[model samples]
Target: MYNLKFLLLAIFLYSSCKANISITSIDSLISVTDDQLYENNVDYITQNAEKILKFSELNNYEKGKLYGNFFLGVTARMHGDNENMVRYTFAAEKLAKEYDDKYVLAFIFLQKATIYKEAGLYNSALNFINQGLTVSNSIQQYEKRNCAKGKLLVYKAICMSYLNPEWKQILRINLEAMKLLEKAGKPFGYDYNYLNVASTYETLGELDKAEFFYRKSLKVSTGNLKGMGYCNLAHLAFLHGRFEDATNYANTSLDYQENNSNKRYRDIAEIYQLLTKIYTETGNTAAAKKSEKLFEYYHNKENYTNELFKKKLLIQLLAKAELNQKDFEMEVSKKSRNLLVFSVISMVLIICLGMIYMKQVKSNRKTIEKNNEQLSELSQQINNSFSEVLELAKSDDPAFIPRFKEVYPVFYQNLLSRYPDLTIAQIRFCCLLRLNFSTKEVAHYHRLTIKGVQTRKTRLRKQLNIPSDADLNLWMMNLG
Candidate 1:
């Protein structure tokens, strides 16, 4: 309970403020790599990119022009500024293709698919994901190819989930993607992949599994993805009729948008719609109106931008379909049937899951208590050992060294195993050093002068043939 409250508080604090990125120079801007920028909050990157675009003479350097546009597109995508995202992506694509940049083309294709996916164009998203995979396969760069392949599989899974909603099929695809990610050793956007799983489960009303993967997604999310996790959690709360919790979570999601400057317009609009419903249901009409007005603000913007994207995407798809109408029709029919069957199954599954939820909740509670109890026991053991070791360090008794060895027997044994030539007095001195005692402290404890302690340390260092530059105290401590 305490941990849950603390987690909530931390989420609140983190979502309530914008993170400030301090890149003040053109050199700093140029040095900001894609991975670094991706990990940053949206607004921070957006503003920094704008600064560089405005102040830096990017035209003077070709690489600068390429990176600048790519960075802008990334920030725009997170911002849900689809128009700008498409524009920047196309510009970058032209330049990349002109330069015969195979690697950058793979990344660009993935980014385009992501933007299309966010814009609710699943077919286009899948097409671009396929293009990305094609580029990935052609690349001989092992790590890059693997990473791109994993990402494409995950994206394909996402497109399939939205288009088909076949939970079991989606799960299988995600499993395949996970294996690829593990092999690649670079699992970028896997959090979103987990999120897609959670969303599928939630659609099926398998609340238990949905909650499990939502938490999993939350565990791995960074930047804008973290905000999306909070939004999903808010929706889950609403599903369970936990209005107050939903309101808190929705606001937290909004805070993340505001802080990160990503401000996903449609998501924010939906959150306000949620807030309005929550407020109205709880007899807060004034608050509901306020939320409704906020909803209107973002809803209008979203509709305008989304419509533009849809029209463009439809035209693009139509042009491609002229020579493959039969294939497109077949694909559409197959996916439509998949969605229909899944929805029917989901309705039946929800009823069954609803019946079992209470029992599962009780079982989960007991399991959590047992785990907490085990954790407490392990923590206590560690604390006790630490206390004994510290006490042994300060003691002046003749048995102090023996007590120390008793408390940390493995450390003592390791030292003797590694340095068998040391004499008894030297071993005793090494033990004192293990406690990180100063020369004066060791002298006072052992009833020897400081100079005597120093001489003993020097002699021990020579016997061990320790490098002069090496920290003697650190070396002794590490022996443990």
Candidate 2:
């Protein structure tokens, strides 16, 4: 019994180890879908992605499930399976957000933009492209960030071409995308960029520039891209009335399309339509009818496919409306929080300024009070000196002149300095005037008649060079 138990325990341990290894291997396998997509192996990607999805579900591997759903959505888009593409893409988006995987989220945004572009919803396409760019910019890896941004910019240019009629702006956006891709060494969509720039040049009626970009597109293109290049060249030739060149170019486009594994029906229809126009213009009635029939056949098929896409789009739009509503609510909440924060900061700043202003006002009030007190004390001291000088002059004391000179030293010095020839009595007369005494009081203090005082004042005015209209007493008080 002990031996049997030991054998069962060993078997269980080995099984557990095998299961862990299998889960790890699935993680690595799911990562290769990106490479498969870049190589244009859509069929292989679909098969491998579906198997990854199954194993991930069985093992409950979240990251594996995310990549599997994303790549499947990419394949679904290539196959024109709009419904499944939307379903898978949204599923991957939900998982990516849960994992906080910015790289996968950026790609998902691009896929959404592409879906909207294919459905002719240019406004919505632009919205997703901008969102993808925002996420791409947040990526820490330089090459990955630039590569992701480059792809989004290409899509943005395509969407803008439909929504905006400004060809120059569209060309600028296309060139910016090419520059970013070149810097990253990715060259993700050079063919698309060249084709778009060529188309823009054609729209601007610059035939030479348009032909140069078309040739550039053909040089870097393969498969359907090469076919598209020939078709656009054919259309350009037709527009310029080169019937033979248009016919040859259109036939070459058709030949390339015939061998393209991933043929674009709309492009094929455009080539046939161009051929029909060429044959009709060149007077080849039989060939014109044949080309017209082929054009109608492919055009009808393209329309049917578009109709199916529109139907699927209607269903997706309903779901998208709900998602948009949620996004709007979150944005509103974010703005509310920001407003609350701003209000609090503003309140704090206002309070600080108010406190500073109040402190300055109090300081100024204290300084003004101190200055007023000092001025009042100085004025009282000057009044006391004036009283003492007047008392001595009123009593006719012998020391009155000397006392007056001490009380008003500057006035005494200015009078003596300007008039050294003045007598002692004249100097005493000036001292009484400097005290602001009335004419009668000055005559009384000097023991002379008012007329004698007036005569002394006239002589003093002449000695001082005072103006005729000036008051002598006033001038003496203001002398220094």
Candidate 3:
């Protein structure tokens, strides 16, 4: 069901919120099988979530609603839908904070840390994981606290592994996690810990140790973890120069992965890369090329770009939140006399600025109108010049480049100064891009396909080191 209230709540929470919550739906979510959670049965999860939310609302069970949002967030995460995952996670955070349940808070915090870690904000991820650890320490249940602590240690190690490639340190942390898991007698869901330790040893150039743990993980794990174990063994086999064994292990990994809905992209990428190397070493150029293409395809298909953007924005928000709290504390520390004096001074400045602004606005308005008239004429002349050059380009006239330079000397000079070796075709594309032409318009103007224009823009962006999210046209305009 389409839920207007839930949608609105999600929006409001993203903006910011507070609410107490119940955990009824959390139990239901926990009881669900991994297959059911990961299968492409979107309608099943959506309907289940809606029912849980509706029941919670009707019964005034805030905990259930909170858990429903968290469940939805996890489901969205599985689907690689970061936007909805963020929304649902934010909603859950609000309720968890309001409820003041240490266990729930710890769990929610761990989920957020994982989300941020996946998004590539290692610093922000580590901060939240520490918060989870602190809260988990306060939990009354020994097994629950131990399990949460263990998971958090693994999460922290994962983030650190990214920030620094010191495999031994990461392995030490994972070992601690493993100890906690063993102490809790709940090591069933944590085969990834072993895989991580093995991968770290592989990174540290300890193939025998890596193989030992990989086999251990395989013995203890099933599904995606088992698939990942096979993937690692394949990579290890290739490293050991056993091409046939590598091929066998890689195929086994793919078979398991193909049968399961849960994804492990790194494992898939590694498998393809290993296969490519194997084929190359075994003198199968055709198979090697195919595997190399597959490797690139999987690597590019990983949702790293958007996730990194989200993480960057989220870290900024977290910094702003901390700054706000510091400002509040400073405000609370101020004396009444200082506050009164500051307020009076601010009011006086505002009134003075208001009168000055009124006179300046009147003067600037007439100046702006005159400037607008001149700008319109200049813009028309520039457009006409561009059109002439474009027509010349269509005819393959050698004079087109010089004529374009004569018309837009500043822009051309700026581009030339920055990129002296830019091709004539690249220069033409830049002119269109600077004029803020859409992809379709640029394609039509150049008599090329849309994909060709897009490819040009992509290549140019990389050449210029422009960020994916940046406005290329605005950036080009500013260059001049």
Candidate 4:
């Protein structure tokens, strides 16, 4: 009985551990699929993604569900299943947003942009590309953010080519995309970049540059991309009227397409069309007729696929439009909230500035008032000193000259410095005149007649180089 109990406990523990391991393995599978999404293995992705979705549902794993749906959407796109692609991607987008997974959200935006581009909705595609870039800004992983942004820019350039085929602008955008991808690491979609730039150079009639890029594209291409490169080269040869080279390139493209499991119908159709023209130009009516028939078949098939895709896309667009309306309303609410916050901040800033200004003004007023008080006190002191000096002079005290020199040192020094030859009597006469004393007052103070005072003034004027018309009393006061 003890052994049986231990065995039961061990079985229970093993089962629980196995279940946890299974869930962990699902997550691991999803992670691996995420990295391999950009590769050419659609079947592997679809198979693993389906398994992930099934087990994720059983285990209630959020991240597993998100990636499973996303990877499946990507595989649907590869297989040209427009309806399932939109459905799975939208489902994944909802989950991504719910979890606040910015990296996956950005990639979803990129996927949507590619969908729109494939549907011939260039403006919509560009809008999604912009949204992808906006979301990519918030991704914490440096390499992931750069890779996401680079892929978006690549699609943006492609959309621009369709909307406005300005070759130089397209070239610049493609080059920028290349730089960003290179910074991210061994760029995932470098073949597409080379292919786009090659087409642009070809359009611009830069044959040498176009050929260089075309070869570069071919060098990196695999599967459908290899066929695409050959088809493009065929078109380039056809454009230059090289019938034999065009025929060879077109045949090579057809051979690759036939062997490629993930065949691009449009590229194949384009190759057939090119072959039709090449055979016609070379005077092979039989081959031309066969090529023309094949071109019609493939071209019609491509058109039928596009029509079906557009119809499904239209339905999804309508649903998306309704969702977009809700999003628009939410955006408007967000903007209004932001605007309110900004207004509050601005008001606070203005109030702060006003307070600072008022404080500064009050400080300046106090400074000015203090300065005025100091000036008034100095003026009063000067007036008291002058009254004492005047009283000394009126009393004819012997100390009057020395007192005057102390009270008006600048005046005494300037007078002596300019005319050092003045005698004591002459200096005393000049001092009374400096005090604004009249000629009679000077005569009374000095006990001299008015003529003697006038005679001294005339001599003093000559000695000091005073103008004759200038008043002597005023000149003596103004000397200092």
Give the per-residue lDDT digits (tens) of candidate 4, residues 11-113: 9999999988998888788777777765656888999999999988888888888988988888888887887888898899999999899999998998888
Query: Tens digits of per-residue lDDT for model 2 on 411-452?
Result: 889888878998997787777787777778877876889998
Off by over 4 Å in 1: 1-32, 37-88, 91-101, 114-121, 161-164, 178-188, 222-224, 241-243, 258-260, 277-297, 308-480
Pull out the clashing pairs in model 4.
none
**Clash totals, every prediction:** 1, 0, 5, 0
Local accuracy by lDDT, each model: 0.71, 0.79, 0.73, 0.80
Candidate 3 lDDT by residue in tens digits, 30-116 = 446223543334557766776676777776787677767766776776676666777787787888888776766786787778766
Q: What is candidate 4's CA lDDT for residue 102?
A: 94
Cα lDDT over the full model 4: 0.80
Q: In angstroms, what RMSD does candidate 1 have relative to the true structure?
A: 32.8
lDDT by residue for model 1 (1-480), tens: 999999999988775542222223454675655545535456667766666655434334445556567678887776656667777787777777876666667878988888667646577678888898888787787766776777778878878877857777877777677666667665456677778778777876788888888778788786566677888888889889998889888888788776764456788888889889889989999999999999999999887556555544433333333424455445555655665566567886765555455455565557556545434443454455456556656666555665566545667999989899878777877877887889999887778999998898788878888988888999987876
Q: Which model, 1 or 2, shows the larger TM-score? A: 2
TM-scores, all models, native as reference: 0.48, 0.63, 0.59, 0.63
Model 2: worst 10 consecutive residues (lDDT sum): 373-382
Root-mean-square deviation of every model:
32.8, 38.2, 15.7, 38.3
